[model samples]
Target: MNVKGIHHLSAMTGGITVNYQFYTEVLGMRLIKKTVNQDDTSVYHLFYGDERGNAGTELTFFDFPGIRQNQKGVSSISGTSLHVRNDAALAYWIERFTEHDVTHSPVIPYAGRNVIFFEDPEGQELALVSDETNSGVPGGTPWEHSPVPAQYGIIGLGPVKLTVRKPESTLAALRLMGFTEKSRIPALVAGQEDIIIMQVAEGGSGGEVQVEPRDDLAIARLGKGGVHHVAFRIEDEEELLAWIEVLNREGLQNSGFVDRYYFRSLYFREPNGILFELATDGPGFDTDEPFETLGESLALPRFLEHQRESIEDHLRPLVTKRD
Candidate 1:
């Protein structure tokens, strides 16, 4: 029972309109799904990535207007890595960011590859890596509003580096979740400079889990632009159940199965307070919309049928068209 690659990464955002513009217009990803946060109706939950909001191509957000900013520290998520096609494309992104006047750090090396680090309007750390081998995604998608082009954009996932307070307990829990310790290596990342620890499975991509030794478990306070949760892919319902059993046997607390529109999810916070979700891959984004017209409209799960009108009423009006 091993885990697969990343399905998507979700974050909290404050500005809805700017967040929409930056992800779609500037970043070049398809706005696959548009809806309000199920828990918080006032905020919008925006999804951006390759066409169809496919796995590894998604970077999701929950927009909270007028919220305070968060501080960058040991317990916080280091950053989210987006894989680009080549060094030339990486350079293109650098120029694009410059053209937009988005303040970014100079190019730095990370994970044995050169990378450029920057933050979004909300201070969520994001980076781009130039490693063709890491992500075999072609950089060209013909979708009208495809991000980075289907081919050159994030085809698959890289690794999500973390700074945990307790490595042993964290490692033990991950191992129970089917993660195996692979190796320790040198990192090319600029911000989290000290340790480069890694572990992974065959179907999934692994990132460095760097532990910054501390006194106790860190309580993460979410503000404007911070990662809300990191989700891992499960092949199907069977895999999801297996993990549920594993977690229960190990005495880990988890948010029992919740049926999301596109996928079924189970939530659990790791020892370090970073929320982790295990999501099923079947009955995917295409379940509601056809492959041809994905992201054409707002789709919701059948269970939320009664709330459809209310949900639609609360969402901000937006449209996606070919430029």
Candidate 2:
């Protein structure tokens, strides 16, 4: 099975209104899709990305009301990063974060690239990594109308940091999925040993994963600000189906196949208990809505269209419009 690269990262949030404002206005991302979680239609599943919510550019959130803050530790997707054009974009973000009162760290190098770590109001661990040196997996185009200039706007998902307790098992799983060890880098988080960096096909910032073995920390508890799962991009349904058989042949259990409407998916937990998903990149966010006003109103998959009234009634009005 040939995995393309990072598909999208989904996370949890406690407050939808604040989250929407921060991502769209503060970070200058486009709300490419406004939909509800399919499993539980009461809460919203907001998708923020570039102009079209391309697979690699998506950073989505599920607003589960009253969820507690994320408990940081091991066996988790510790951090998610976004790709900016170059080092100069880092400076623009620092200034923008400061202006908007977004808590952030100074510029620093991690995994051979300059990045600035920052947190949303909900304490979501995130970073903006410069793609000045990238040569592999190309980045998506930024929304032309974003408040942040196109050069400074986030273009795509960058290398994701996965902190797990059992590095060998996770490493083996990754290798089975076509990733190879790239190199080792110092752990970005203090008190941890060197991190093992791995990359899949045409690896670069977009196609890499940083694996940190942290036996010293406790297992992370799921809550607001915690990442739900990180997905790897698959070229098409055929590739996805072939992978299912590969995983089954190896005796590794997995979600046979799930149609997520926008994209098909196969989910499973690695040895360390971190959820991993393999999702197709096609049938994108534009499948249901018009290209002009993608996220202007609530959008339901055809399957859920019948229950839209009840779904809308349970959801509180989330104001995303700017004056």
Candidate 3:
């Protein structure tokens, strides 16, 4: 089965309010869903994306207040790259970042594309890549209330960078899951080895994954402001289950099949220890609420409905900042 592209990338956050403010007010993404982690309902599971909360556009956060800062090193998803329209869009983001006092690096070239590196309030690494030639997936809609104009708004997720102790075993696992090695690029960061770019069928922004060898670094500890898992898009349940079969056949352990309400998911860690997930794209954010009122209120899956009151009381109230 062909994995289409990125489904969504989920990360951990130290402060939900700060995360909400930066992603919504500063970055101009819509808070498309306000829900709690299904496995552990005390913490918030916030989903931010385009107006419709499309698959490739979603960037989710699991709020764990007062959690220890993640120790950055090998065996973790080090950064997430977002695609922009072109150089003009990159300039717009630079200006906006300056205006908001968000710390960011100067535009840098990697793999022949111009990119600006930055971090979220909680220190999750992020980048904006300019790819004028590539038009993203069809039917993506921009958030109406976004401060950034639609033309220059972030198109979707770009390649996710993973810091691994070694690339050989990880590359083998990725190939088993249908990723093809594209090219090897010089490391943009000091002290790191070369970067290997891989992609699914004819990859675009959300379809690419970068593997960076960082054997000298320490093993990463999962905590606040660290990536939990990188989810790649599958067409539907059929494709999702097929991947489970493939993983099992190859003797790789996976989460079997998990129904995440918005999407069905199967999760497993690559040989280097970076978590990966395969997620379906349908029954999306609009399942519980209409497109017009998405993210307007706290939403819970049917199983959690019984504890809605308790969950609401546990989570701090979040309000979107709109112009």
Candidate topping TM-score: 2
- Off-target runs (Cα >4 Å) in candidate 3 are 135-139, 189-192, 321-323
Q: Write the per-residue lDDT of candidate 2 for residues 1-323, one digit (tens) a residue.
A: 67999999999999999999899988889999999999899999999999898888999999899998899888899989999999999999999999999899999987788999999999998999998888788888888888899989999899998998889899998998899999998765588778999999899988999899997889999899999999999999998899899889888889898889999999988899889999999899889888888888899999999998999999989865434
Task: State the lDDT at 25 in candidate 1.
Answer: 70
Model 3 TM: 0.96
The CA lDDT of each predicted structure is: 0.66, 0.91, 0.85
Q: What would the C-alpha RMSD of candidate 2 be, to one decimal place?
A: 1.3
Model 3, 176-250: lDDT tens digits are 878998899888668877899988856867778888997688999988889999998888998888898999998
Arranged by lDDT, best first: 2, 3, 1
Model 2 lDDT, residue 303, Cα: 93
**Candidate 1 deviant stretches above 4 angstroms:** 133-144, 147-151, 185-194, 203-219, 320-323
Score every model by TM-score. Answer: 0.86, 0.97, 0.96
Error of 1 at 73 (Å): 2.7
Error of 3 at 22 (Å): 0.3
C-alpha-based local distance difference test score of model 1: 0.66
